[model samples]
Target: MDSSKIINIIIALFLPPLAVFMARGWGQDCIIDIILTIIVFFPGMLYALYIVLKD
Candidate 1:
């Protein structure tokens, strides 16, 4: 796919909140990603991947 997406995926794997922030800006998606990351890292990572791939 796109290089930026690949980078975002890598970032998402390491830090989901940051990845969401980069993709969606300071919005609800970013907040949700932060919460999910705080609650459970795996779920947050998955959510971030979904968000990134969706666009």
Candidate 2:
């Protein structure tokens, strides 16, 4: 994977919302990530990684 993808994955592991924001900005995906983080951490991480990888 690219360096940026690696960075995003690392960030997603630690802070899912931040990773989503980095990948998608302050858009719907980021908002959803934040909400998922608030509800549960693992789901947020998965969602963030999905967004990062999907892009």
Candidate 3:
């Protein structure tokens, strides 16, 4: 992966919603990430990693 993806991964691990927003822009994915984060952090982080690294 390039530097950006690497950065996104790091961000995803720490802040799932922001990472999802960075990867997907403003959309349903962002909302989902936010909701996941609100419900529980681990799942949100995992989802963020998936979204960021799936390129």
Candidate 4:
């Protein structure tokens, strides 16, 4: 993957909201990211990646 994606993955793994907070541009996106993380649990990194790439 690209460096930007890698960085976002790291942030997502260490701090899920940090990646979403940096990648998205709206409050609703952040809320969605949080919800995805909570719902998926261990797969939160993948969810964050989806959120970042979707943007």
lDDT of 3: 0.92
Residue-level lDDT of model 2, residues 1-55, one tens digit each, is 8999999999999999999998889999999999999999999999998999999
Per-residue lDDT value at 26 in model 1:
98
Point out the higher-scoring one by lDDT: 1 or 4. 1
Candidate with the larger TM-score of 1 and 3:
3
Candidate 1 lDDT over residue span 1-55, tens digit each? 9899999999999999999999999999999999999998999999999999998
> On residues 1-55, what C-alpha lDDT tens digit does candidate 4 reach at each position?
7898888878877777679888885588778777777887556667777787776
Lowest lDDT 10-residue stretch of candidate 1? 32-41
Each model's lDDT comes to: 0.94, 0.93, 0.92, 0.76
Give the worst 10-residue stretch by lDDT in candidate 4.
Answer: 41-50
Q: Answer with 2 or 4, whichever has the higher lDDT.
A: 2
Provide backbone clash counts, one per model.
0, 0, 0, 0
Model 4, residue 20: distance off in Å is 0.8
Highest-lDDT candidate: 1
Query: How accurate locally is residue 31 in candidate 4, as Cα lDDT from 0 to 100?
Result: 81
lDDT of 1: 0.94
Mind giving the per-residue lDDT tens digits that candidate 3 earns over 1-55?
Answer: 7899999999999999999899889999899989999999999998999999886
Best-fitting candidate, measured by TM-score?
A: 3
| TM-score for predicted model 3 compared with the true structure | 0.95
Off by over 4 Å in 2: none
Ranking by TM-score: 3, 1, 2, 4
Error of 4 at 21 (Å): 0.9
